[model samples]
Target: MSIDQDLSHVQSLLDPSEVIPPTSPLYGPNAQGWAVQKDLHPRLVAVPTSPESLARLIAHLYKSHLHFGIRGQGFLSASAKDVLVSMTAFDEFHFDPHAEVATVGAGQTWGAVYRKLKEAAPSYAIVGARTPAISVGGTVVTGGLSWLSAEYGCISDPENMLDAQVVKSDGSVVWASTEPDLLWTMRGGGGGFGVATKFLFRVRPYPQAIWAGPILLPRQQLPTVATRLEAFLASNPDPRVSMFLYIIRKNLLETIGAFQDMLVVHAYDANGEEHGREAFKWALDIPGAVDQTGVTDMEGVTKLQQNVDKSKGTMRQYWAPLFLKTLSAATITRAIELVDELAKQDSAVSDCTYLIFELFALCDAKGSCAWPRPPGAKHVILIGAGCPANASAGQEEMARNLAEDASERILGSRTVNLLANGGEEFHDPVMIWGENLDRLRQLKKVYDPNGRFQGPIRA
Candidate 1:
C-alpha cells in the first residue's frame, strides 16, 4: 500500500501527466461517482489516451495483482481503492452510412451520441440509453434498457452489438467476438471480464418523428390513472409506444413552495403524432392536468427525457428495479400504497424521492440478451429515493431503506442492474446473469484469472 511507490511505478510505465494522485485537486472530483454515497477514494487515477496505453496499464495492474475499476461517465460506482482508469480520453464517434453502423467509444455519453446522430444519421437510430448523460460502454455491457428496446431489444443484444474491442488482462487487444465466450459474456453479462474500449452498433431505421412529452396530474388521481394504465397494459398496445408513469412529490418537481405530490406520465409513440395521440387520448383528456404532449423528432424526444430525469449530479440517490408479472389492478394499488408509506414514514426523504413505472408493450426482442428478461412481465417499477450530499449516514440509510423496502415488496425475485445501486451487494453472479452465471464465471477466469477487474459479479 505504498502510494508513492505505486504512483511512481505507474507513472514510469505511462505518461506522467496521465497519472493523478489524491493530492491533485482533480482527484477529489475524479474519485467520486455519480451518487454521493459512492464517494470512494482511489490511490491513483489513470487517464490513458489510446487503447495501447490502456492495455499496458491494465496488464501492469493485473501482473501486480492490484485491483482497479474502470470509470465510464461515472454512471456506476467504481471498485477502485488502488487505481482508477478514467475512459474520458477515449471519446470517439464515427457512423458509417453504407454499413449502417456506428463505432462508438466507451467514453461517449448518450447525449453526445444522440446529437451526432441527429445531425448525420437522423434517418437511423441505435438502441441507446434513455438518459442522456449515461455512458455508452457501461450501459451496453451492463444490460441497456432503452426506449427502443421494445422494438430492437437491448443495445448489448447480439443483433445490436455487432462487435466490441476489449483489452484483456495480458495487455493483448482483440475483438471480443474472436473469443466467442468473451463476446457472449460481454453481451449483457455485466463487466469485469475485461476493459471494453469501444463497440460497433448496428443502427435501425428512424424514419418518422415520434410523439412524446410529459404530462403532470394531481396525485389524488392515482387510482384512476392506475386503472387506465392497467387496461392499457392488458390491451396490448402497439410496440411502437412506450410510457413511463412516475409518482413524485412537488418538492423535486422544480416548483417552489409546493410540496404536494404529482403523477407524471411521459408517453412516447414512435409511429408519429396521429397514432400516438390517439393511443394515449385517455390520459391527455384528464381534467386538471398540465399536459405538454406533442410530436417531436429524436432530438426533442431525447431532450425531453433528459429534462424528466433530474436524478443526476451531486446527491445521495438509490434506485431498485422491480419487475412485475402483471400490472394488475391489485398490484397497482399496492404500489401506490407503498409510495404513500414511504412519504409518511419520513417527510424529509419523501420530498426528494420519486417512484417510476415503465409500461412497455409486448416486445419479442429480448430473446438474445445475456441478462434474463423477466418472462411474462411488461412493466418494470423503479423506486428512487435520495437525500442531500452532506446528509449523515443515518439519513442515507433511511433513504435507502425506504426505496429497498418498496422494491422488495413488489419484487418476486432478485434482479440486478449496475444503475440499481440501492445499498445491495451484488457479489452473486447468479442474480445478474441467471442461467449464464456459470459460463460467465468460466470466461472471467479465462480472461481475468487474477480478478484484476472490478464489477458487480465477483469471480
Candidate 2:
C-alpha cells in the first residue's frame, strides 16, 4: 500500500483530532525531550483517545509492516524515524481508596495523578521523583526509583502493582495482570514489551510534612564531610532518609580559577518535623561553608530536592549506574578523586559532570516485582557526566574519556538503565535487554509473526 493509503487506514481507525500526518506542525517540528541534544521527529504521529481506537491503530500498523515509537510526555531519549504513538490523549483516572490503588491512563502526568489522589486520600503515597511533569507510565516501566525508593522500594515492586491494560504487538488488547508471568515482566520491562494503555499502582499512607533541601559545603571540607556521611550511614541506616552528594564546579569560578567551587550535599527525609530535625543535625556536624535546609509538604519537598534547572538546555548527558555491595570509605575516597580529576580537566560543559550516590537497602528481594537488580546488591551509586550539546568535538571526546575512567575506578555491577556509551565491553545484551527482550521476541513471534512492527530500536 502507498504511504497515503496507510495514513488513511490509520485515520479511519482513530479520531480526526488524534491523528497527525507527516505535514502536521508537530510531525517534523523541533520537539524538545528530556535530553536536550536529541531531536524528536517521526514519520507520523498518532494519538488515540480510546482503547478500541488504539487497538485498531496497532492492528493497522502491524498489517502495514510499520513499527511505531511510543511516547509519554516526550521525556527520555529519542530514537528512530518511525511513526510516533503518543499516549497523551488517554488521560483517564480512577482511584479505589479501599484497595489503596489508583488506575490511571498512560498519558497522564504524575502531577495530575498526585493531585487527584491527594483529594481522594489526604495521605496517599505514590512513587515518583521531584519532577511533577514526568508521566507515571514512563517512570514505572523504567523501574521507577525515587526519594522513597530506599524505604518502600522501587515503584515496580509487585506488591504495589495490581494490573495493566496493554495492546500486544499483534493488536490484541489484554488486561496483562491476569497472567502472572506477563504481569511480572511488564511491571518493569519498559515499553519494549508492549504499549501499556493504563496502569494500576498501589498507594500508601504518608505524613503531611517532609524535610528536604540542599547543604552547600566548601571543596576543602570533602574529607570531613565524607567521613561524617560514612559514619552516619554506618550508625543509622534508615531507609526513610535519602541523600545525594554532588561534586560540582563553582559556576562563577569557572571563568576565574583552575578549579570550580567545592561540593554540595542534598538530603531528604519523608518523616515529619522531628525526623527531619535529627537528619539535619548530621549536616550541621559536617564542616561546610553554607547550609540551606527547609521543611515542607511532599509536593514542595520534591520540587526543592530534585530540581535540576542548571542542567537544562541542549546537553548530551551520559549516565553510569553502579550497585556497590557497600559504599566503603575506600570507595567514597575513590569517587571523590574521580570527581576532582574531572573538574581539573574542565571536562563537564556546564555543572553537568557530577556523581550521584544513592544509598538503599534492598535486602527483601522477593518482596518487590521481578525488576532486574544486582544479585546480593545492597547500595546503588549512579555516577553521571553531563556535557553541553554544542561542545567541541575535542571536549566531547574528553567527556567520554572521563566517564570511562570513572566507571573503571568504581568496581561494582552496572545497571542497564544508565548504560549510554556504545563501547563493546559495556554492551552486554543480557544486561541492556534484560528479560524483556526475550519476552518481547516471544510475543512478537506469536502476535506479529510477519515482523511488521520493526522500528529503529528493534526489541
Output the worst ten-in-a-row residue range by lDDT, candidate 1: 417-426
Residue 25 shift from truth in candidate 2, angstroms: 5.5
**TM-score of candidate 2 on Cα atoms, chains taken together:** 0.84
lDDT of each: 0.74, 0.63
**If scored against the real structure, what TM-score would every candidate get?**
0.91, 0.84
RMSD of 2: 4.1
Best by lDDT: 1
lDDT of 1 by residue, 1-459 (tens): 465676678778888778888899877555667677775677888989899899889888887745578988787866477888988777788899999999988877888888888788888888888888778888877777778877776778788888889998899999988988788777776788889889999886884578898888777777788788778888777777898887756766675343577788899999988888789877877775777788777767777767533454557877666655567766777777776876677666665666778878224444455576556655677776777777778878987876666545754434532222222452244544567667777777887787767766555
lDDT of 2 by residue, 317-364 (tens): 555565555566667777877777766677455356657776653433
Off by over 4 Å in 2: 21-31, 36-40, 252-262, 305-313, 346-350, 361-363, 375-378, 400-406, 412-426, 432-459
Clashes of each: 0, 3
Residue 433 CA displacement from its true place in model 1, Å: 2.4
